[model samples]
Target: MHSVNTRTLDLNLLVVFATLWDTQNVTRAGERLALSQPAVSHALRRLRERLDDELFVIGRHSLVPTARAMELIGPVREALGRLDDVLQGSTAFSPATAQRKFRIASGDFVEFLILPRLIQHIASEAPGVMIEVVPLPANNALPSLLENGEIDLVISTPVAFGAGLREETVTKVSLLTLIWQREGLSPGRFPLDLYLERPQVMIEMHQREGNIIDASLRAQGLARRVGVLVQNFMAMPVIASQTGYICNLPGPIAQAFAQTFGLSCHQPPIDFPEPELFAYWHARFDADPGLKWLRERIKECANTSDE
Candidate 1:
């Protein structure tokens, strides 16, 4: 292998390389980089000569990356991300005029609770900014997602994250039991006997053994019958309203669903733990002004959610 001289390499070529890797088509890559297709091709040609490898070849519909290009992408992305963070740290982030997109990973519960207020705020204060929210990956993949710059932030219930990640408790919320108004459930605390007797609609996001509610019930030598198991919190309200099943959800979400679906919210019969929603990010981008502003905005939304 021939070692390439870094002094002669143009940093913009790496940018083109990374963008080309993301978008296999040269035309699409050129559009993303705001360069003409010919310019992109010229840069790719220069990069191929400098690296002495055919980094990409024309495929049926797109440019397929050679094995060498595949091996180079990860480190290139990491380096570019680090450089961007450094530049962003030195620049002032004026949300009012800044045109940037933040990618966030979160569950639907966060979407229902925090996003409305955040979007409204952005519309008035940061009209040029964009927000993209994606579903949270598996528990183990979160750290890598943040470290690799795949996601800008994560909003989720408290979970163990790997090293080099920073976490802050955005809000703490207690569980509320949701029941159909037609069931004639009282306005106060739900009865323990009735809670156990009624079939429950459980939100099981992961395939874990049991949730906090189940653990508390087991401590009391009791277990509620899970009549229907679901992977999303959005489904719980509809299921409970139609089937008369009980679902325990976070306070804000429970209230929101109850109001939307004309259900009732009551305190859970068991002693349920108040789960804290956390915002997770990689330590590498700790000084990024845009991300810092975003975190503050999220905290503000969470603080006002109950109000």
Candidate 2:
């Protein structure tokens, strides 16, 4: 087998070698790689001289690699992949002293309920870290965005995957509760039918497919006419404050929004499942060290907010 003079090679030559072997012709490889064809040809000549054999030879309008070139392909590709592995593996998040730009996307309720404390944490711990909160999308492709390096991380309860996606539960929310006039309602949880029938109001994302109110009502063979339809949780307090309408929302969400809107919250009279919030990442970043640090900081932020 032909051998290369290992001592006399620059590291980037391996990249040139791999590209030529994959495409065979230097001209085609250069075109594929956006290099001048002559540069690729010159690179190949240097590789041939350094290796003591022509790596490829002219064939019918193509270039055919020599036996040594074919033998080197697998190992060369593996080496490049390993290099990537070495470069992208670890994390550090000492928020008390970190400087980073963190991007997040979620509903306004989560913004109101959770993020205030996280911001405070950053202010104290990683004063250099800045938060860029994005408005919620109807159906965000967060996993893909993570892979493509668009958004850094996602925070929400709902998470699913086609592939290469992961979500770790950041927090589990309490069941939906009612936000009613503080003076009139019973002190404890309300009765389902009474709560449902008592001039109910619903808040839903405008672009969301269907509201839980509609689905739940249909499931139990019962339905309550919605007295109000608003897009954001921000309005739940304002609308529910003076009106007798009861707002059905996640306990934490209702409680938080109520503070802002001057309303109140309680467990619904009926039983319903609680929602969850999670931090999701793409597997592509599974080995990314910087990402690991970001995840930890986010987890810390979310966890500390609960306390």
Candidate 3:
């Protein structure tokens, strides 16, 4: 392969290529870039001539990337991201004047705890900014999502993120046992034997061999019966309120649910460690002012005093 001259290459074509790869339809790509269909086609032709390969081809309805396009996309995205960071770094970030969108991946709990305050702050301070919250990807997919710029930040419980990520502990949350207003149970600390006797509502976000509570119980040769297993924390409160089962949830969430469902919150009989919530981001954007500002805002919101 002959070396192509970088001076003769139009860097703008790479932007077009990335857009095309993302949209997969000429009209859609043109709409995203504010370019006409003919202009986009001409840019693709120029790129093909420069690289001596047809990077994409017309499929049944949309364009499909060739192996060459697949090979180029990763590096192309990285290059563009770095270039964006460099350009953004050159200017001071003014939240009041800047029009930007930040995407965050997190669980429903984070949405409940943080987003309301964050949105209020944004509305008052940065009317032009927008926040999009997406469901957290699986643990193994997190690094790629951050690296690929698919998500700007992640708010989650501590997890082992492999590499190229930065993390900071935002807050530590203790668990509160939520139970129905039973005859024997009171509003204070629950009794150990009573807690052990009652069936529990378990919140399992991921399918795994075992969880921290179970592992801790196993060490002491203790186990509780699970009456219901659920994927969503929001459902746990409803199930706990209606049934004889109990659920352990973060303090704020449990209190909120207790108020809404007319349930009772009690201190768990057993001592369990508080879980720390962390904010994670790609290390590549460590110096990006907008992300930095957003991270601070998230931290502040997470640490807000309970009402």
Q: In candidate 3, where is summed lDDT lowest over 10 consecutive residues?
A: 203-212
Give the better candidate number (1 or 3) by lDDT: 1
Candidate 2 backbone collisions, by pair: 90-289, 95-125, 95-126, 96-125, 157-276, 190-269
lDDT tens digits, residues 38-60, model 2? 88888888877777778789999
Cα-based lDDT for every prediction: 0.87, 0.67, 0.84
| Per-candidate count of clashing residue pairs (backbone under 3 Å) | 0, 6, 0
Candidate 3: C-alpha lDDT: 0.84
Candidate 3 residue-wise lDDT, 220-259, digit = tens: 8988788888877889889988886888888889988887
Cα deviation of 62, candidate 3, in Å: 6.7
Model 1 earns a TM-score of 0.74
Among these predicted structures, which one has the highest lDDT?
A: 1
Model 3 clash pairs? none
RMSD of each candidate relative to the true structure:
4.6, 9.2, 3.7
Instruction: Please provide TM-scores, in order, for all candidate models, with all chains considered together.
Output: 0.74, 0.64, 0.78
Model 2 has an lDDT value of 0.67
Where model 1 places Cα greater than 4 Å from the true spot, the runs are 1-89, 206-209, 259-262
Worst 10 residues of 1 by lDDT: 203-212
